[model samples]
Target: MGYCRSKDLDFAFKVFEEMALKGFKRNEVAYTPLIHGLCVARRVDEAMELFAKMKNDDNCYPTVRTYTVLIN
Candidate 1:
């Protein structure tokens, strides 16, 4: 999230991937920041893709904030 806030998306994505590889249970908390960062970076397509992935995950779902981020 610090990475995202700093606009260091490459590192942010690296950390995101690492979380998965390390068996972290990625939830909305994990996905939202990346989505927000992507949106901030004008990478809406990638953000949407990530959002789709989050939606498909059995244990994860978009929150109101998630939708709000994307919509904004």
Candidate 2:
């Protein structure tokens, strides 16, 4: 999140990938910041892809705020 806030997406992604590799269950809690950051960075296409992945991903449900973030 700090990384995302800093707009350091490359680092954020590395960290997120590490978390996933370590078996950390990445749900919307994790998805939100990345998606929101991507949107804010004007990379909405990537954000939308990530949002869709959340749907296919097991146990990862997007919150209303997630939609709001993307929509805005």
Per-model TM-score versus the true fold: 0.96, 0.95
Q: Which residue pairs overlap in candidate 1's backbone?
A: none
Residue 46 lDDT (model 2)? 97
Write model 1 residue lDDT over 1-72, tens digit each, in one string.
Answer: 899999999998899899889989899988999999999999999999999999998789899999999999
Off by over 4 Å in 2: none
Candidate 2 has an lDDT of 0.92
Q: For candidate 2, report its TM-score.
A: 0.95
**lDDT per residue, candidate 2, 1-72, as tens digits?**
899999999899899899999999998888999999999899989999999998889999989989899889
The local lDDT score (0 to 100) that residue 9 gets in candidate 2 is 96
lDDT of candidate 1 at residue 26, scale 0 to 100: 90
Which segments of candidate 1 are over 4 A away from where they belong?
A: none
Write down the RMSD of all candidates, one decimal each: 0.6, 0.7
